[model samples]
Target: MRAKAVRMYGTRDLRLEEFELPEIRDDEILAKIYSDSICMSTYKLVEQGKKHKRAPQNMDTHPVIVGHEFAGVIVKVGKKWQDQFQPGMRFAQQPALNYKGSLASPGYSYEWYGGDTTYCIFPHETMELGALMPFDGDSFYKASLGEPMSCCIGGYHAMYHTNKQNYDHEMGTKRGGNILIAGGCGPMGLGSVSYGLVCDYHPRRIVVTDVDDAKIERAKEVVSPEYAAEHGVELIYANTAKMDDPRQGLMDLTQGHGYDDVFVMVPIPSVCQLAGSVLAFDGCLNFFSGPTDKNFSASMNMYDLHYTSTHLMGTTGGNNDDLIEANQLAASGRLDPSVMITHVGGIDSIAETTLNLPKIKGGKKLAYTQFDMPMTAIEDFAKLGKSDPFFAKLDQCCRDHKGLWNPEAERMLFEHKGVKVEV
Candidate 1:
């Protein structure tokens, strides 16, 4: 089959190209990708390219496709997978295959198996490892956002607090405890907030901190304070950009008790240090962000770690179980991952959009693979509507969902006018 995809040839070299995919083997499955969410980690992969161990070393031999957060439909199932996955079934992936202790993953490691393409083949290893998960959901974006959401869920599970009695550790975030999310205005930050509130984390108070007030407002629009209150969760937003000490406000919010669970959303050392500083007794800090710097280190108060029993940990990506949980939550309407999307576009613009993702403001950039339209921000939908009625409908749909995209909008979009592609 002929398909369009974004390929990374080398460092700072991402190109959109046409390619042919071979027939699926007996142990393989073919998927037609429809929605892919752009991630900041892709930016690091683009800049680092072959220098990164996760990416293919020889670009000429393997011009890798560049995206991981994606969702699609199963177009063709191999002989082995026919009973498990059928044609026209929706699907998403865990992506962090980590096959046999190798550094390779689908988006960064594979030449023909990334999310940027219209169609991709799932190799035997992926099937064996159980990374490709089938989902039943209304919005494809929800499936695409599943991987990142699972990352948040995984981090919460990775966190552990030491028991004063047994001296052992208890895993997972504390229920009915005060939670803090540092740099909680970005896409993942927003996801962490929504998931922490909705799922079983059950935080008594959830505090989100960011430098940009506008971003904090945007975050509120996604997960309103009133909505949090309705869920029996106290959601607090703080701007630490102007404060002399960012941790002071966090401590104040908890009445100088400090946070029971701290999730560091930013990769900077200072932000990690700040997250650690605001830890309450028996607090567990989960460093959620992955940094490019090899020597990135944050100072830790060893005395606090030993006496107060606070500890820190980090995870690169979620396992298969976490992805399944994310999908289940989205399907059940308990979790709305679409709040993470800021801009929507077509496959034609994804190459440039992904290359310059760091410069682009707002949250996740979502792509409708068959659509040919230029990138449009959700905030600019009203303006775009004046020029085109299609965008006007999209504007209403997004507005109906409180300035965020949803399954109804997705169906209405394709039913009204989407770039039709017959695979």
Candidate 2:
């Protein structure tokens, strides 16, 4: 069968091309992708291409598809998996396969398997390793957001603190302790704050710092201080750019005691240094940002590291269990990841939006694989609606939902611009 997808042929070489897919083997499954939200990691993938660890070395020949945070419906279940997954069932992918310590992963390693594609083949390993997960969410976009939300869950789980009794590391963040998400107003940063409110172990306070005022303001609207208070957590959005001494200002919010857990959201060395400076006794500084530079270094306070027992940590893509937890959070209405997505597009918008993801000023750029429309931000819906009726309807849906993307907006998008399959 033929399907359209954005494939990486080489470094910064992404093409939205229609290609043929091989017949699904008895051990494999065929699926139709609906929603895929672009991630920063995917932008890094395009920049490095075959040089990326998860990407195969021969991308010039065997091109790989370029998205992982995706959700879809099972179009045809393979004979071997009939009892497990059936056609028309919703599914979400946990792309960090990490099979047997191999670097192979979907989006970067496979030719006919990725989120950008209208259709894809799930290899046997996706099921064998239980990475292909059932998504019981209201919309396919939420299912796509699950992949990144799971990443946030994994970061939360990966944090470790100094166990005073044994002095051994205790996994997970400190409960009822002050928390900080530096450079956190971005997509994932917003998610980290939202999760902090409803996480099993609640924090006393969550201080989010970002350099951009617009982003900080937008984040507040999504997870406001009032909303956080209802969950018994004090949330503060601080724009460090406005502060003369951001480090001092941030420390003041914690009453000079510092934070128990600090998650660094940006790859900037200064942001990382700032996060390190605000660590309290036995604080766990999570290096959540993935820098492209191999020699990226930051100066941390070594005195506190030695005497305060403050430590650093880092984690990559999430595991299948994290994905499951993320799904549960979304299902139970505990984690609304809508703050992560900013723009919506169609399959035709994949290549450009992905190739220049960093240039696109937004959180997650969601694309519905079956549609044909330009990439448009939710904020611009009203602007575009002034001239176009299709956008006018989509604008109303978003306006009704507090200018955020929701299932109704997705439904109206489909109703206005029905499926357009060239193949």
Candidate 3:
């Protein structure tokens, strides 16, 4: 059997190619992928090429499929797995695989199933134990969002302030506690927003900061007023580039104090510095995004950290339990991650999409192997040059606030077309 997949040949080089299906082992299950979402990590890997040491040995040698977040229907289950999995059942698979005695899967590797393909053969180890969730949901797109949401759940489990008195009470008062999500416009940031809204120790106010106007607009749209009212949380969009002091904006929002919980969704050096600087006394700063280069470093006041009793931690990938909880969250309509999905294309579009990832903005891009849509290569889209109205406005905003717009801020402003001028 031949299946379609986006095969990466080298750094910044990928192609949609056909490959013969491998024979299914006795305990394996074959799934027909319905939807797969692009991951920022994938983009980074393609850019690094051979420098990405974690790429599977054989995968680096041969053309490899390049996606990890996806959902599908179990089409064929091998003999021993047939009873547990049935044909035509909606499901999502956890792509992480850990051959290392450790419990979690490596963040970058092809042994881990890649979702950017037509069909997938899930090994029993992951399918039986990881974040694979059963979904009888409306669409494959919705089911496909499970992996990303599960990653958010994992982040929540790893560091979120729980309602348990031991946790919240020890930190501080829970009622008026504030949570700040920096770089809150990307897919992971949006996931954090959804999870933060539903947390038991829900912050009195959830401050979402992003330089992108479009992302802020979309964030506002997804976090409807009704949801905000019921949850007792207020979503604030801040243009980091415009604010004289980004940390000051957060402090003012929390009434001169900083946030009790701060999640840094982007691993940019400046964002890390901001997170470390603004975290409240006894606050917890969770770094959700993994840093790309080893040279990247952020400056912080060690004395402040020592005196405040604050905690700083980082987590990657999630466990099966997180995926299960994510599935429940979506099924109950408490969190609709599908709102973050904006574009969907077939396997043929993966190469182009990956290449243009840095330029695309607003929402998550999805790739599907089984369905074909009016797909256009992102490269074909005309670049919004400096002469464009939005670009001009963005440049002016950055120029006016010279100190505020860091590299991350500049990228967000460009990607989201968010330029706020005084009326």
Candidate of highest TM-score: 2
**Candidate 1 — what's its lDDT?**
0.86
Model 3 per-residue lDDT tens digits across residues 171-280: 32244678788998777887888877786657688788888787777677666545776787787767787888887876888888888788888878888898888887
Of the two candidates 2 and 3, the one with more favorable lDDT, higher being better, is 2
* Candidate 3 local Cα displacement, residue 348, angstroms: 1.4
- The runs of at least 3 residues in candidate 1 whose Cα sits more than 4 Å from the true structure, single-residue gaps closed, are 416-423
Q: Which pairs in model 3 have colliding backbones?
A: 67-115, 213-418
Q: For model 3, how big is the CA root-mean-square deviation?
A: 10.1
Model 1 poorest 10 in a row by lDDT: 414-423
Top of the candidates by lDDT: 2
Q: Model-by-model lDDT, in order?
A: 0.86, 0.88, 0.68
By lDDT, the candidates rank as 2, 1, 3
Tell me the lDDT of model 3 at 85.
71
lDDT of 2 by residue, 230-299 (tens): 9999999998888889889989999898999999998998888888988899999999989988789999
- The residue-level lDDT of candidate 2 at 230 comes to 100
lDDT of 1 by residue, 1-423 (tens): 887888899888988889898888899998889889888888889888788879877875679888889888888889997777788888889888878998888779888898988888888888888888788887788999999999988988888777757867777888899999999899998999988888776889999999898999899888989999999999999998877877787798899999999998888888888889999999988888888787888998899988998877887788999999999999999999988998988888888898888889999999877666577788898998999898898899899888998888777766665534233
The root-mean-square deviation over C-alpha atoms between each candidate and the true structure, in angstroms, is 1.6, 1.9, 10.1
Q: By the lDDT metric, which is better: model 1 or model 2?
A: 2
